[model samples]
Target: MDVSKPPFGDDDAHLRETTVSSQTVYQGHFLQLKRDEIALPDGGRAAREYVIHPGAVMIVAVLPDGRLVMERQYRYPVRQTMIEFPAGKLDAGEGGLACAQRELHEETGYRARRWARAGVMHPVIGYATEVIEIWFADELTLEQRHLDEGEFLDVFAASQDQLEAWMQAGQLTDAKTIVGMMWLQRWRAGHCQFDWQTVD
Candidate 1:
């Protein structure tokens, strides 16, 4: 490995693309499709199509006994039930942390006394501008869940070991959930650090 070069190399020299024009192909309740003409580094022009997302947040809620709060919900796009952390899209003008807090309560009926932002990940980088902020919640309190009218899910708890086993067995396949699990495992082992915050 050549340590002198940055891991992804210099963005300006090797990774920059200039957008020439953009067009919105479709706009839906939650997503907007866009097509753009861009000038590539090699002086070639190309068209790219992608989705414009409003961003979202995912929470890894930890109970006092070290179990994680999780959810099983049916995803329409994939036509399969998914195991995921409590998450929701950012409402119009909503902040990421606020969305995380609201999602945890609305989806799992649990509120945390302590919160920490783990990190962020772009689940669909190739064609979508969706960024999900990962958060960790602890010191939880049970509360009434207020799910959306047509929303349905089963909220449950699982130990870290159980989650690890599930992941190994290919049972947990949601991208954000897998990223959350990785972050939790690393943080627990002191390989990663989180800036914890008091509940607002």
Candidate 2:
């Protein structure tokens, strides 16, 4: 999908997407980049570097009994196996909810009965276009799990204590996971509202 403009119904237009140029920072594992680009509406283009990433999708899958389904995976860069929510990158032109449903099935062998867009967060705003959509996935039932060939990970359904332990033990450090958890928290606490606003 095009990060050149925020998704339709994104009311916040704090930053305009100017024309850009990207340089590869790491071409292995996950794609990483450094972008030096123009700043729209400013009339003067400055060299602002960010990771030119095809933003990803994730799920906060809630089980029938209200338990959350998460995962444990070894991240080579971080050199640790962290417990994280099910997530993956978007296929070109793929909708974010589709990616979320697909990933939840692939990683945990579960499909959701109800789906809603929770919110989005830029994982690394200082240097990335990696705006990940953290969805609220509910009414889940077990399905067949089909892992991708290159993915090395484990499937785990965790309780609140278990999740807190993992976080305390230095796992669950992925930026997207943290934001997803917070998104869930805020929504449950009645602190959030999801709406789409078209860009001009």
Candidate 3:
């Protein structure tokens, strides 16, 4: 399938909403909330509130032994420790590949010789303007981690079978990690192809 084009052409016009007015409700160091008045397709007016984010990248790094690099960290919003792929927000003016590489190294201390962009996913389309760009990394070499200040996490490795079992047991619930696992499985099954590149 050609991913460059939208699945439906002009048929989606009826579902489109035009922004009448927009206001910033709140602004933080990383996220901005916006409230907008939109003109509905049915000639009605409505308000929409959503977050404006800088976007992020999630890395699915594989060790030489086939174990996937993972992390366990406390998420304040959910009040629970979560298992997730190495991920981080994009710094100003950073490209997707650059963000992926930096995030993997900073969070897990693993740099990859070969990398491929799997796909992008919108985890919260209902409220947030955030999208996670997924990248698959292999040929990893361990280095020193440079975690951000106040960031606390435990970096570990797990196999695909273990991840699948965790998901079945409701132990792995991070959406991006789950999606990354699906991409890995699909690639392994030869359902898709990745144009992998080597980087220094």
Candidate 4:
């Protein structure tokens, strides 16, 4: 259905908000909080606050047996251990595919010989300007993992059926991982296709 293309049409002029003024409220290592005064479509002024994040990449790595490589880690903000696809934020000036490759190898010790970019997702559209680029990887070879300092996660493999079961049983709650599963299912069902690239 070509969901990436949005029909902005003439309604955009009526719904768009123009930035009047913007200022940084807080700046972290890679995240920045900004508050902006915006001009509403109805000629009203309002303030909008949001977080600016360095975009990230999520990898849906698959084994030869079709099991998906996954991770379990504790998220401090949510105070819960979450299962997710291997993902990481982009370093300054880093490309999406590079980040995906690095993250998959670092976290899961798997280097993919074939890769395909699926699409991008905005996980937190309301309060954060964070976009995650999704990639699918196969022909994986296990290697030594080099997790970043203080980063801790357990890497495991699960079949698509297991993932679906978890989702239905309220266990798989990671939005990005769920989206990856959807893409995987659609691709497997021939509803969509990926332009696979062989990586050295």
Top model by lDDT, which number?
3
Cα lDDT of model 3 by residue, 145-191, tens digit: 99999999999999999999999999999999999999999998999
For model 4, state the Cα shift of residue 167 in Å.
0.8
How are the candidates ranked when ordered by lDDT, highest leading?
A: 3, 4, 1, 2
TM-scores for candidates 1 onward, in order = 0.94, 0.74, 0.96, 0.96
Estimate, for each residue in 1-200, the C-alpha lDDT of model 1 and write its tens digit: 99757897555766688999999999999999999999999999999999999999999999999999999999999999988889999999998888989999998899998999988999999999999999999999999999999999999999999888999999999999999999999999998878888975
> lDDT of each model, Cα atoms only?
0.93, 0.76, 0.95, 0.94
Candidate 3 local Cα displacement, residue 166, angstroms = 0.5
Look at candidate 2 and tell me the lDDT of residue 105: 85
Worst 10 residues of 2 by lDDT: 191-200
Decide which is better by lDDT, 1 or 3: 3
Report the alpha-carbon TM-score of model 2 versus the true structure: 0.74
Sequence-dependent TM-score of model 4: 0.96
What tens-digit string does per-residue lDDT give for candidate 4 at 117-185?
Answer: 999999999899999999999999999999999999999999999999999999989999999999999
Alpha-carbon shift of residue 11 in model 1 (angstroms):
4.2
Model 1 TM-score, 2 decimals:
0.94
Model 3 backbone overlap count = 0
